[model samples]
Target: MPSTSISTGSAAGPAPCLAVSGASGKTGWRVVEEALGRGYRVKALLRPGSEVPEGLQGAELIRLELTDQAALERALEGTVALVIATGARPSVDLAGPLKVDALAIRQQCAACRAAGVKRVVLVSSLCSGRWFHPLNLFGLILVWKRVGERWLEASGLDWTVVRPGGLKETEDDLDAQGIRYSGPDQQESNSIPRRLVARVCLEALDAPASIGRIIEVTSAAGVEPLSLEQWLARQPQPA
Candidate 1:
């Protein structure tokens, strides 16, 4: 483990720093954007080959492989929290899910521990852990994602697993869409915009009740909008 620490702030004050992995991806960049918009200083972590997106312009970018323990730890050091938006992409490589969804999550958990980062939020899918799902055809992604979620749960850190339904790229009419959030595998079929997912990730960070919970989300025109805190308040504590 490396002893590197990110500078918090000097003259202004101590602004909490947030590290967002997979920052170049659609969801990752939005998470960074939302974090910055919420007044948190952000460190956007991307792969070396990942093309920098326009959304990451305001944040500090650190390019490194997640498998590089030293670099990962260095990126996470001094950051108050981390949002893991990394997921395996569809490709010819059959092992992509196992490597990215499972192994990489384990690696990130270890790095967070070594870096002294206490808070973590993972972006997973709605049907995660299901063996008979259609999405599992892509390298058993749902299964691997579940494995990753379990590892994070047992990581002994303040963690939240956000499993969203089918992701939509459209950012239009966001205000009209209300998010339906449930506990664990409640809602298996629906869709949500990536922007909404980004907002919930940040919301989970602010809500202490979200820690150690698996929040499943989806959106629609008629669903009533509610903050993560509001929804958490209505649910019974996990036994």
Candidate 2:
């Protein structure tokens, strides 16, 4: 590996392959499409019974549950980096948050180490480490999400945690929205387009400064969408 460091918002080449889990979800599919549009190869990891979203057809698809160690390892093989877009879908089962958010994160980190995939970007949530928040009502989801973020932070892998505010489904006028980037525990209570969140995940893969850092993001109209590199240069690194 000749110099793994990269300026933010850029990947190595036209073929810098990325493996994306939860590729069946709306956000996951968009992440795959954006990666492809940017000229990077992508391996989409879906579940055994996951419906194949149309946009993901051209990319390499790997199907397996997160608990399947052999399949997980093989799917992540040959990828330089990974973006974890998996999240517990809204469910009546209260334990879904812990199982999918925290435990699954630990499993993926282990697989990354085994497969020699050193760079990872995690899609975390706002107020993750907080004890008193509404989302936590869902089986202490905020607490568990924090656990997941901590797992990646302590895993010793090159990692970045992107904590986005409330998610939205709107795509039109997205170009008019600018991502408000901040350090961990900074901004909260605003929403960002899922497409922008996907872009930030890919951007972190190519940003050396992004590693070992927690970046909070939310978007709003009337603000200039700044590049991650430009934002990073303006802030003092966490010490």
What is the per-residue lDDT of model 1 for residues 1-239, given as tens digits with 9 covering 90 to 100? 12222233345777789999989999999999998888889999999999998999889999999999999999999898999999998999989999999999999999999999988999999999999998988999999999999999999888899999999999999999999999888988989999999999998887777888899999999898898889988988776
lDDT of each: 0.91, 0.86
Q: Roughly what TM-score does model 2 have, to 2 decimal places?
A: 0.93
Q: In model 1, which runs have C-alpha deviations exceeding 4 angstroms?
A: 1-12
Which candidate tops lDDT? Answer: 1
Candidate 2: clashing residue pairs, number: 0
The 10-residue segment with the lowest total lDDT in model 1 = 1-10
For each candidate, give its TM-score against the true structure.
0.94, 0.93
Which prediction has the highest TM-score against the true structure? Answer: 1
Candidate 2 local lDDT, 1-239, one digit each (tens): 22365332465444667899989988899889988887778999999999998979779998899988778988888888889989998889999989989999999999999998999888988888889988887888889999999999889889889999998989899989988998889986999989999988877766677888899999999877698877877888667
Q: Candidate 2: global Cα-lDDT?
A: 0.86
Report the Cα lDDT for residue 224, model 2.
76
